[model samples]
Target: MNHESQKTTIANTVQLGSDLSVNRLGYGAMRLTGQPGNFGRYADWTAGKQLLRRAIELGINFIDTAESYGPGYNEELIASALYPYPDDLVIATKGGVLKTAPDNIRTDGSPNSLRRSCEASLKRLKVDRIGLYQLHRPDPNVPFVESIGMLAELQREGKIRHIGLSNVTIAQIEAARQIVDISSVQNRLNLAERNGEDILDYCTQHNIAFIPYSPLGAHPLKRGAPLANAEGILTEIAARQDVKPSQIALSWMLHRAPNIILIPGTTTISHLEENIAAASITLTADDIKLLNEAQVF
Candidate 1:
């Protein structure tokens, strides 16, 4: 009922690269694989598949996933859920990292590794070319330019449609542009974490999509004392809105930037619906000012 009535859910969309266009509020497939560390097989694979299918039925066309998620299973799960592929669906995926543990994330940005990952992802996703392929992380062991070169090569070969970068800096993005046309950038952004502000600003100015993962942000926020003070301010606002604190938290991101494409992941259906509905909640100017002040970091 809410899905049908939430008329303002991401009413606008931003273009990505040459062809792909997606609703601003998209779904992240990371949580479908399992818990946060997300290093293993999904406990309930069927439910995961169903959730992906359901998301599409709800009008979410852009689904963000990564090869590291399930390291492979997540992509396969997607193929199973929506294999023939809808014409408008943009299934974006990332590579260049392997999840060994919940806390451990390793990168292999070698040309060979990058190529192999892209090929593997293409097969599992059941697509000749990925709509959006992003470099997951910059490997300190490998030259960043070389990694971007590999993506450029993939683009020329027609394996990747649009190129994106994740967990990158402004200099890195500028460096990547020399090698390929960067369409989007995925970074950790949310109401609680404001460190990616500069990168986001650059993306917006360039007309590139800023796909923000962890849009609700992490728990036990690192900003100890300052965050504690801000929560009181945030809670007060939420009480006035008659919505959950988390909803107000996500709504802030939706209103924060037009270029920000949110991918807040969750396996629960209720949470999925809640996230989709965030684009419908319009935060007033005063509300935006309040949330901005709450981000003490």
Candidate 2:
């Protein structure tokens, strides 16, 4: 289908790599698992399962998860929701971070450990080949090249269709680019976090899909309160555009770069719909400048 035609298709997918194509709007399954390690704390498993189903129903073909989340709970939930999976859906999962405890997340880039994690992720995801497998973090203990080389090996073996990196530096991204084709880069970025700007710009220049995790801050936004202090720019511009502050925040990211993709996760269906709808709002150049100059982060 043509690009414009595909845009209207919720199941419409876009190719980010030689073998990876997923819907523009996607879901993140981290919240499906319970706090600490169980599945009982957040919401009903049946309800969580329905959330996944609803996301697909809304045309979110890109679903992101990590092995470190619930250490394994998110992947299993994804399998339950998507097994006998849709042909157009893309399942992206991360490795490299090991959860010592629910609150204590550590990065381990040992080649052997990465292989083992990929094997396990494959089993839990119920797919012979992952659509996009990412290295969750760069391991200080292992040479970066060695870690990326292993992912390249997996791609060649048909175990992973594409490779991506998360929480990496520009130098690290450049280094990985040399070892293998990097299709996507996941990083923590929000209206409150601009530390990843350089990498985000680099990805734009290189034609890589930049996926922003936590595009909305983890903090609770007060009801009817502005995103910034009174008279702050976020509120002013959002008011001018007739959009919510969160929508403005997301629209700023999309305005920053066209290659950017957002996977804002929430257990609440209303919030999920709001996040997806942000893509429809357009930010003018002036709107982007105000957001960039706000200096909140």
What do the candidate models score in CA lDDT, each in turn?
0.82, 0.79
Question: Tens digits of per-residue lDDT for model 1 on 13-73?
Answer: 7789857778877898877665656656787988988888888888899999999987687
Q: Relative to the unseen true structure, what is the C-alpha lDDT of residue 193 in candidate 1, on a scale of 0 to 100?
A: 81
Relative to the true structure, candidate 2 reaches a TM of 0.87
TM-score of 1: 0.90
Residue 257 of model 1 has an lDDT of 75
Q: What tens digits encode model 2's per-residue C-alpha lDDT throughout 221-275?
A: 2122123233478878878768677777866776667677778777888877877
Residue 37 accuracy (lDDT) in model 2? 47
Each candidate structure's TM-score, on Cα atoms with residue i matched to residue i, is 0.90, 0.87
Model 1: how far is 228 from its true place, Å? 14
Candidate 1: misplaced stretches above 4 Å? 1-11, 101-103, 219-231, 295-297
Q: After superposition, how far is residue 181 of candidate 2 from its true place, in Å?
A: 0.7
Residue clash pairs of candidate 1: none
